[model samples]
Target: MTLAPTRIEATPERAPDMRLYESLVARVSRPARYSGGELHSVTKAWDAHEVRVALAYPDLYDLGMANLGLMILYDIVNRRDDALAERVFSPWTDLEALLREHGEPLRSLETRHAVRDFDVLGVTLQYEACYTNVLNLLDLGGIAVRTADRAPEDTIVIAGGSGALSPEPLAPFIDAFVLGEGEEVMREVVDVVRAWKRDREAGGLPRIELHRRLAGVPGVYVPSVYAVDYHEDGRVREVRPLDGAAPGRVTRRVVESLEPPLTKPIVPFMEVVHDRATIEIQRGCTQGCRFCQAGMIYRPTRERSVDEVVRAAGELLDNTGYDELSLMSLSTTDHREIVPMVNALMDAYGDRGLKISIPSTRVDSFSVEVADAVARGKKHTLTLAPEAGSQRLRNTINKLVSEENILTAAENAFSNGWTSVKMYFMVGQPTETDFDVEEIVRVASAVKQIGRQHIGGRARVRVSTSNFIPKAHTPYQWVGQADPATLRRRHQILREGCRRAGVQFTWEEPEKSLLEAVLSRGDRRVAEVIESAWRGGAKFDSWSEHHDWSVWQASFEEHGVDPAFYAYRTRDLWETLPWAHIHGGTEPSYLRGEWMKTLNEEITLDCKRDPCNVCGMQTLDGDCRHKIAELVQMKVDGDSTQKERLMQERERLMMLPVISAP
Candidate 1:
C-alpha cells in the first residue's frame, strides 16, 4: 500500500516580533516598504474574520503597489464583513538575505502575521518573469514550495492574472489557477477555502478533496488533476482530465460591464511606479492587434458610463489626495463618449488644478483632440504605440496604423503646443526584415523634423522598441521569437540610425525577451526548470541588475529541458499547444483564421464599428452583438447634428471593402 504524502503543519497566527522586524527595516534601504501603515490600508482583528486572504504580488513594493488589479481585489475582499485581505510583496534581495539569516519568515504588511498563517494566499502573476519570485515568496513564508507537500490546513495557493491564462509553467507550484477576471471568481475561491477549513476543523479533510471541489468551480483549473501526454517528437498529444470534476477546457470568466470603479485606493507610504488616482475607463480593446494577448483574452470590450467615470475620478482624488487622475484602459481613446467624458471631467475639476491623463491613445487626430482637452494646463509629452515600423509589417501584425496616421497625429500634437513626443514600436515582429526595422528610425526622424518645424529646437522625439515575444492566446502564438543575434543587430541599426538622425531611441534586452517567450509558451516540464532556477538563485529575472541568464541556462541543462523547444521552435498548426486546454474566450478556429490573414498581410475591420467579424466572443456571452447594437443605439440617440455625423461616417466606412488594409 502507498503511504500518503507527508502532511506539513500549518502555521499559527501571531504578530511578528516587532523589534526584530523594525531593526531589519531600519537596516534596509527602503524601510517604508515594510512599514505597513499606509493611509486607507485595511487591518482587522486576526480572529474576527473566518476567511483571511493574503494578496501577494511577487515583486518589489515599488512596482506592485502601483498595480490596479491587486488593489481592486484587495478592496473587494476587504469589503466583506466576514473576510479580510492583507498584502505582501516580495522582499528585496537585501531583506531576503536578512530574513533568512535571522530565520524569520515573510509576513503580511497589514497585520504582521506570517503568510503561511492565512487561509488563502492569492498571488497575482502579472508577467512571466515573476514566476521564480512566486516560489521564493512561498518558501520565505514558511510554506511548502510545491502543492503536493502542502497539508489540508496550509494556505491554499491560488494565482490569477494575464500570466495565469498560460498556467502550465507555474502549475506545479500553484494549487489552483483562477483563469480570468478575478472580480467574481475570487469570491467563489474564498468560499471553497472557507468551506474546506470548516470541514477540516470538524474532522480531518484530505487535500485532494478540496482540489476536486475547486476544479469544479467555473474559471478554476486544478493542474494536478489533469494529465498531459506527449507524442514521440515531444509535442503535447493530449491533455486529459484524471478527475470527473475538471473540465476538458477551462473557460475564462468575464465581467459583463466595468461598473462601480474602485475608489479610496490605498495611498502608498513611499513612491511607486505610477503615483496617481486611476479609473479603468474601459476593459478590452476592439482594435484587434493580432499580436496582443490582452485583446484576445479580454474579448467583447466593456466600458463604464461617462457619469460613473466622472464620479469615480472625484472620489479617487478626494480619497487619496492625488493631483493627477489617470483614465486607464487598453485603448482609452476608443471609448465612445471619450470626448464628452473628458469635457465633463474638465468642467467639474478643471478649476481645481486637476490633471486628467489618458495613458493610451490611437494614432489619429481624434486622439490629439482628447489630449488637447486634457492638456489645458501642461502638455508634458504625447505618446503613441505604432507597434511595427513599416506599413507592410504593420499589416502583417494587423496594427492597422499607417505612417500618414502617425505623422498626422504628430503634426496635430505639435501644432497644439506639445513639444516632446514618444512613439513605441516592437522590433522582431513576425515577417519583420532589416528594412522594416530601419523604418522605425526614419519615422522617428520624420516626426522629430515635424516637431522642429512647429517648436524649433525644443521639439524632441523619442522612440522605444521592445523585442517581440509571442504571447499564448494570440494569432502570433504559433510563431517563434526572433533570435538574440538578429534582435541585437536590428537594435544596433536603430541605434546608429537614430544617432545620425538626432532622434533618441531605446530598446529592451533580448535576453529577457527570450526568457519570457520560453516561460509564456512552456508546458508541464518547465515547472522543474522553474523550481531549479529558483533554487539556483533566479529571483527578480525581470530586473536588469539582478537577472543572471547563466543561472537559467544552467537550470535548463540540469533539468534536461531544452529552452529552445519552447522559445525558438515554430509550432505546427496541427500541434496541440500547452495552453490548448485553457480557452481564453477566443475560439481556436478564429485565431487560426487570423494567423492565415496575417500571413497574407490582410487586415480585419474593427468589430466595434463594422459588422461583427465573428471572432468567437459572440458565442461566449452574446456580448459582441449586444455591445455593437448598444454602441449604434447610443450614437443614434445623440443630438441630431452628432447623430447625422456618426451616420454618415458609418455609411462611408461600410462602403469600403472590409478586407482591404488602410
Candidate 2:
C-alpha cells in the first residue's frame, strides 16, 4: 500500500509569499480561521505525500477543533507517511458572505489548498441538521452536489459519524457512508485510496476503478453500487446491491480497548461549543430507553479502566491547557468505579482550579456525591434526565428511575451547595398523556420545593423538555412521532403549568423537532426532500435563526411526500424500514419484543443490573464485554411491570387531543 516514488513531488517550490495570503485574508472575515499555523498542527511539503486528505467538519473553526472524532482520524491518517491529512470547516455566515463575494473557494486550514484539490474529502456527519451545511460546503468547493455527477479527478466525498446509521437521507449527496466508529476503518480507507492513487499515477487504472475498490471496503456504502426500489406508497421496498456488489449491510466497528491515549487533541484559539478536553469514560448505554437511538446504536456499554481515564485526563489537561475536562458517556454515574474515579480526579486536580464535568448522569443519590466532589468551587448546575414526568411513563420507556429517587437526588444536589438543578423530559414519547405533561410540571414543582427546603429561597429549579423523535434501530423505530400541532399544544401545557408552579421551563421549538423526527425516521425517499430543501436556500437548520421550516415543508410538498407519514404515523411491526438491512448489532427480534413489552407496560431489566434476558447482544458475539452485571449488582429499584403500565398509559394519554378551554 506504500506510495510510489513517481507519485511524490520531484521538486519543491519556494514557499508562497505571506503578503499574498495576508492580502486575501484582509478581504475575508476571520481570516485566521483558515490559516494553518497552529502550534501542534502537522504540515509537510506538498511534494512529499502521495495522497492528500482534507478532513472537514461542517461547522465553525472553534467547534471543529474540539470534535474528538475529527481529531482521532486526523491523527491516524497523518500517522501514514504517504498521506497528509488537513482540516477545514464551514465559515460563519458573515465570513461565508465575504468569501462568496470574493469568489473564494473552501480551503484547508493546513495547506491553504482548495478542498477540491484534495485526493479525498472526508466530512463528518454528526447530525441531520448539518445536511444543508454539507451541501453548501460542497458547492463552495466547486464540486458536484450529487455523487452521480462527479468525475474520477473530483475529490472522493465520504461521510461518517452517528448520522451514518441512517445515511439514506443524504445518500445522493455523498459518494460513500462509513457506518459506526471510524477509528479502525478510516485507516483502512486511507490505505486503499493511497494504493488506488498510486496505480492511477502509474497509468495502471482509472478513477472509477478506485471508487469500485473503496466500495468493497467493509463498513463503506457506495450508493452507486446499490439500486433503491420504492413501493407505490413511497416507502422503500429494498436497497439492493448491483453488479455483483455485496448487500447494503455495513457493520459498525468497535475498538477492542481504549488504550493508546488520543493525547494530541487539537487546540483552538477561539471559544468553541465544547471548549474542553473530553475523556470517553465509556461507550454505549444499557438503560434501554425505547425512544433513544444512541442507547440502541451504541450498545453493550464499554468502559475504559478508571486508572486509564484518570491518566488520560491529567495528560490532556497538561497537553491542551484546558481549564475544564468532560467525562463523556451515556450515563457517567452508571460506571461501576465512578466514585473512585471522581475521588481520584478531585484528589489530583481539585487544587489546580480544574473543573471536571460529567455530561450525562443518572438521577441517583450517588450522582450528587460525584458532582459535589468535582464541582467544589464551581457554580454547579446538576442535570438529570428523568425522561418523563410520571413513574408510569418512565417505566414504559424503561427509564427505571422512580419519582422518589429524583426528589432525593435533587435534595442531595441542593444540600451540597448547588443552587440550581436542571431536569430533562421528552414530549411526544410513545404513550404520553395530558396528565404526564402536567406531571412534568408537578415533578419540577416537587423538586423545587425540595430544593427550597435544602438550599433556601435563592435556589432555582428548571425543567427542560425536548420533543421526542423516533429514530432507527431502536424499539420505537416502529412508532411514529407527534404532529407539530400536538407538539405545540404539549409545549404550551408544560409552559403554562411550569409558570403556574413557579418553575422555569425551557423547550425546543416544535417545528425543528418535527423536522428532526421526519429526517430521523425517513427512508431513501428523504434524499430527494433533503436535496430539495438545500436547493431552496436551506443551510444551518440546526440554528434557530437560520432554520426555515417552510422550506422543509415546501420540499416535502414539492416531492409529493407527506411528512406526517414519517413523523407522526405509528409503524406496523411487519412494515419494512429503510435501514432494516443495516444490522446495528442488536437483533430486530429483540427490539420487536421490547416494543411489545412497551405496549403491555412490561419493563425489561437492564442487563447491567439483572440476569441476561438474552436480548441478542450475546447472540451478536458474546456477553457484554464490559462484564456489566458482574461489575454492578442488579437491584430492582422499584416495581417493574406496574410502573411500565403507568408510563405507557401516560404516554397514550399525552397523544390524545385536549378540548379547548371554555
Q: Estimate the Cα RMSD of every predicted model relative to the unseen true structure.
A: 6.8, 6.8
- For candidate 1, the 10 contiguous residues with the lowest summed lDDT are 1-10
Residue ranges of candidate 2 with Cα displaced over 4 Å: 1-31, 203-208, 619-662
Estimate the TM-score for candidate 1: 0.93
Candidate 1's residue-wise lDDT over 1-662, tens digit each?
Answer: 12222111233344847568768878988889987868778777678789999999999999998899999999899888778899999999899999999988898888788889998999999999999999999999989999999998898999999998999998889999999898989888888888888898998989999999999999999999999999988899998999999999999988876649988788887888888889998988868899899888887878899999988888777777787899999999999999999999988887777888888988888899999998895896999998887878887887767788899999999988998999999999889999999989888999999999999999989999999999998988999999999999999999999999889999999988999999999999999999999999999999998899999999999988888899889999778999999989888888899999888877776777654667777757667867546556655675465446545553443322235321
- Judged by lDDT, which candidate is best? 1
| lDDT of candidate 2 over 1-662, digit per residue (tens) | 11112112334322343345445666666666777656457666667888788998997786677688888888888888888888889877776676677676767777677788888889998778888899999988778999878876679899988788887888788888887778888988988888887777788575557667877887787777777788887777887877455556767666555546686576666666788878888877887888888888776777888789889888877777776888888888889899898888877877787788888878888788888877775756898999999877887888877787898899888877888999999998988988888899889999988888887788898888888888888898888788778788888998898888778999898789878878877877888888899889899888899999999989999998888888888877887788766777677898998898787776665666544555555634334633434323323444455445545644443422221110
